[model samples]
Target chain A: MMVPVRCFTCGNVVGEHWEEFDERSNEGDEDPEAVLDELGVDRYCCRRMLVSHTDLVDVVSPYQ
Target chain B: MSEEYDVEFVEREDREARFLVRGVTPAFANGIRRAMVADVPTMAIDTVRFIENSSVMFDEQIALRLGLVPLTTPPEGEFVEDDTVTLSIDVEGPDTAYSGDLVSNDELVQPADENVPIIDLKDGQRLEAEADAVIERGKNHAKHQGGVGVGYRHLQRVEVVDDLPEFEEQESQIVRGVIEEDGELVSTTEFDHDLSKRYPGKEVRLEDVPNAFVFHVETDGSFTIEELVTRAADTIEARATELEDAVQL
Candidate 1:
């Protein structure tokens, strides 16, 4: 996953919540907002980090 | 400047707190903010050595993640910048790696929040690394910031010019100030910023208290909110002492 260690805009640590966010978002059982709120990420900037991230690590690792 | 100030707690949580400091200058309030953000020292992973990695994340990325993990600061006079606390993590998993996985040499110097995830590993994927925690100030790097969301706003003064029927209906909802039935405004009321927004364009006007400040501080679990504020005040005092020494010299 292309998760950043901290939110670029607000500097809140967001990477820690990415795994759970990714899992629930994929499950489609709960809205992203509810998941984010449960994760204690209330700011819009931190919220955007989880919503827009793509897992590119798997795609690029083979080249290394 | 010698006037005594009143500190009233507005809200208190484990990691966040809000308080009102009356009878302080704006400069003094700002000094607290700057000190909390830059002067207070905290423990953070500063260096990492990789032993094995079959995961998708690069070694540098893993190290960066480790460095960002907030560590609990050792008691005052217990931390030494040159002294490094070792942290090692080894996991073979079809599961997620967490900050709790990293074991520290010192019990007092470990991850402040254990739930921080480092990486997700699939079956057959392995990751191993050793990290060093060191004490540092936030001015050097954000990873060492003792606290976050350290800020203050001037306390506001609300006055009612003409209490109309519309204003009277919303008066009960306003906790900061009491709107008497005869439209008299009380100055001793508590201040709440939301009150102004709840009733916009009413006969009320909000004014700023130049000397009164409402401060909010949020920690990253590195230290208690009380510790952060106390350290900030200590930092300000140290700076002032240095300035006095310089003038004497």
Candidate 2:
């Protein structure tokens, strides 16, 4: 049997059938948004929703 | 003031090879480019190319796991003189990482380049068990286009003092290790560049390495964790067979 793999970021199933949850588990549970980062993909920004100071720093401003 | 902008990556109108980033002001875009440049670590001169040009794609979650500072958007740019984003990538610096728990070092995040587990020969298993740990490590390293880099071992052969004294004419093999001017394995042999002055008792000769000695992985002048382990195993096995063949009276 295949082990279910939750998205690294969202901790949610990578994908699933919407109504097949009666016997399976939680349904309509939206995977958390990927917390965008400076380096690369955020495969772990699930449900926690922690805002970051660096993420809000002078990113829009131009560096000298 | 904080400003958040949606980064739209678009291919350049002219340069097919290079893509252009739109929606972002030149200053913001240049700042992002500079940020990537800073990521080169000590290889500050090393260049980073955002192939997509318009939008940069990456898994930010891993970046956080690595404890790297984030520069999401809003006041993003080279502004906010108080705040700075430096490239925490270890390889960019003057030194490259090796196979060890070096990533946890406070100075930089240099994770082990390779993880080839060496099975203890004394474990009483004939032939040897599957190199599960290291075999898997090698496969992982082979995935990226980088595959792996073979760092030079720079092994030096030393002549045993007692043997040298007894048989001034006969040649024999001996173990060698790096020692400081004070005679210590504190650093790489290369650090003993001034061998003559530091090691007054004996000079460590760099040119005395053996040809059969597996100093590197293969063609590349670099060393890999797997290569090192394999070389060591082969050496031990060969020595054991040689000893078996020798009818020591």
- Residue-level lDDT of model 2, residues A1-64, one tens digit each, is 0111122332222112111321222324532232123212233442222221112112421321
The worst-scoring run of ten residues by lDDT in candidate 1 chain B lies at B177-186
Q: On a 0 to 100 scale, what is the lDDT of residue B59 in model 2?
A: 23
Q: What lDDT score is found at residue B67 in candidate 1?
A: 88
Instruction: Write the residue-wise lDDT of candidate 1 on B97-177 in tens digits.
Output: 788899999989888877777887877889988998889999998998987877887766666676556544554334442
TM-score of every candidate relative to the true structure: 0.85, 0.19
Candidate 2 Cα outliers beyond 4 Å, as residue runs: A1-64, B1-147, B158-192, B201-206, B212-249
How many residue pairs collide in each prediction? 0, 38
Per-residue lDDT for B1-249 in model 2, tens only?
034433221212210111222244444433333222221111000112222211111323222222211111111122322332233222221221112311221222122223211111111211100100101112122211011122222224333233223434432223333322222222233434444333344423444232111121111111232333334344345556889889676
